[model samples]
Target: MKYYSTNAKAPLATLHEAVVKGLASDSGLYMPEYLYKLSADFFDSIQNLPFNEIAKIVATAFFGEDVEQKALDEIVDDTLQFDCPVVEVSDNIYSLELFHGPTLAFKDVGGRFMARLLQYFIRKEGKEEVNVLVATSGDTGSAVANGFLGVDGIHVYVLYPKGKVSKIQESQFTTLGKNITAIEVNGVFDDCQALVKKAFMDEELNRHMKLTSANSINVARFLPQSFYYFNAYARMKAAGKADNLVVCVPSGNFGNITAGLFGREMGLPIKRFIAANNANDVFFKYLQTGKYTPMASIQTIANAMDVGNPSNFARVYDMFDGDLQKIRSVVSGATYSDEQIRETMKSCFDSNGYILDPHGACGYRALEEGLTDGETGVFLETAHPAKFKETVESAIGAEVEIPERLAAFMRGEKKSVEMSADFDSFKNFLMTR
Candidate 1:
């Protein structure tokens, strides 16, 4: 399967090349030149298969012969060591709990899989080493840092918005040493993402360091994320509840929702995808008005989705052949304010006895507002509520227990370098690292 840039200027590339190059020379997100739709039989075959087997089928569609089935199985087995539990929060409304991984966020699945896939590609090409440059609003940094930490031939540098991420989220990336390094940008998530994109486009930097990305902009990150959509569907099928289902995803950079669309293309029986976003909802506005205008990101409790202009919009637009009407038909976008998010959290707890973080609350709100009757919707609990304990507890009037894994992290020392969002500062830091 060859991939082409959405900008239509760069040459088509195989999956490995797309993974390695990340952003195309034209500064466009890499999309498959052709998408092979899965047949009904293909979906039925994996309905009862193990997670690893299902992952192989889903992954091989994009990876093709570049990655062997055995290799893909190992990568899946290693990456998905935890469960993505689907719990019923209310009647016909379920929460896909995706925070059971090392980083306690949904990005762990993609981050870990991308790290392993990159390792495989580097080995196949006989490359000595590669450096992964990632930008995170909150979860991606820790997920990338932990996933590639201590890998033999890869080093990860994570850039995050300073004073924007949660304390635990910050500690998760900054505390890890060895192959992982964290740089705090004195700006929003967009600034950090812009710097990373600029670095990838910088030919001089490419000569000095083989720059790869673990951001959602990377095809590697997007492909592995498609697996969980199938995983959730399979689980629903086993319980005799699989039908036209809606997935409510908390949109940040829009990569998560785009991957869900890929799964839908690969024969997943999804009715519609709801792009749940915070106050800075560029996609929401674009879906409503058919006009795309990016503004500066606004601060919100759901800081991850605080992207004013998501970098993954290029991929989303490309998926629909740049047709705004086609995108609007399949996707229903909604944005929630901080006050609305808190109210949604309170209502969900008071009504269903379930706890939700701000991001999950945004998804829940979208589902409550936009869900059609008889349509089953699953809101993605992207992060554990305990990750935002202060907010969750204050809203619900109760204390949430921290997971044992996160407890260990609270005691670790944090080590991160603070820098301005200037290219020179980032470049100088990379040179020293």
Candidate 2:
């Protein structure tokens, strides 16, 4: 399979080049020149195959002969070391638990897969060194940091909003010292994202450093996310309850929802998608008005979705050929305030004994608001509730137990440098590093 930039300027590239370049020279996300749809028989066959087998089939289809079968198998083994459990939260609502991985967040699938793929690519091309630049609001930094930690020939630099992320989220990135460096920006997530994008576009920087990205903008980051969507369908089929299903995703950068749409295009039996958002509701407004107007993002308890201008929305738009009607037909979007998120968390716990973090609660609220309309809606619980312990405990009047992974985080020492959001400051930091 060959990949081309959606901007139509860059030449078609192999999967290795697409993974390494991240964004195209024309500043577009890379997409396959052609998408190969999976047959219905293949979807039916997934129920019998192990998760790793299913991943290999999907990976080989997109990556072709670039990644060896043995290397691809190792990639799947390392990436999917957790379960994506679909727990019934009520009569009509279900919560897909996606926090069982090492970093206890859904980004683990994409981050880990990207790291392994990069390692394989570097080995094949005989590159001596590579640098991965990423920006995150919460879970992404830790997932990327942990995924690429101590990997030979690669270094990861993560930038996050200072004092905005949860304590645990901050610790996850800052605690890892070797080959992973964390920088705290004094602005919002958009500011951090802008710095990373600018670095990729800098010609001088590219000459001296091979700059890659682990953010959702990378095709590598988007591809592995399609696995869990198929996994969810497989689980439902095993229970003999397979039907038209709608997935409620707490979308910030819009990567997860875009991947789900990709799965639907690949023959997954999905009815629709709900793009749940916090106060920074640019996506919600775009779904309603067909015009994307970005503004300053507001800080909410669901800090991850606090992106005013999501980079992956460009991919979503490209998927629909800039046709608003078609986009609306396949995807629905809604926004919730901090108060609504808290209320939904309390109600879900009281009524169904499910503890949801603030981000997932936004998804539950979106489902409750009738956006899904009685469909078998599965709201994605993207992070462990312990990630937002204070909010969950105060709203539910109880404590959320920390997992062993997070308990270990408490003992790790945090190491990070604070910097202004100016581009010159970021450039200076990169030069010194």
Q: Using Cα atoms with residue i matched to residue i, what is each candidate's TM-score against the true structure? A: 0.98, 0.97
lDDT of 2 at 362: 86
Candidate 2 C-alpha lDDT tens digits along 1-433: 6888878898888888889988888888898776678877888777777676777777776676677788888889988877888888876677888998888999989999999899988988899788999999999999999999989999999999998999999989899899999999999999999999999898877887898999999999988998888888877667655576778899999999988888888788988888999999998899888889988878999998899999889888998999999999888888899999899999988988889999999888877775444467788999999988888899999989998889888679999989999998988778766
Q: Which regions of candidate 2 are displaced past 4 Å? A: 371-374
Q: List the residue pairs that clash in candidate 2.
A: none
Instruction: Give the Å shift of residue 277 in candidate 1.
Output: 1.1
Rate residue 216 of model 1 by lDDT. Answer: 92
lDDT of 1: 0.88
State the weakest 10-residue window (summed lDDT) of model 1: 44-53
Q: Write the per-residue lDDT of candidate 1 for residues 1-433, one digit (tens) a residue.
A: 7889988999998888899999999998999876668778867766687766777778778776678878887898999898888898888888999998998999999999999999998888899689999999999998889989888899888999999999988888898899988888999998999999999888878888899899999999977898888888888887766787999999989899989998887678899999998899888889888899999999899988889999888888888888998898789888888889989999999999999999999988888887777788888999999988898888888789999888888878989889999998898777765
Model 2: ten consecutive residues of lowest lDDT: 368-377
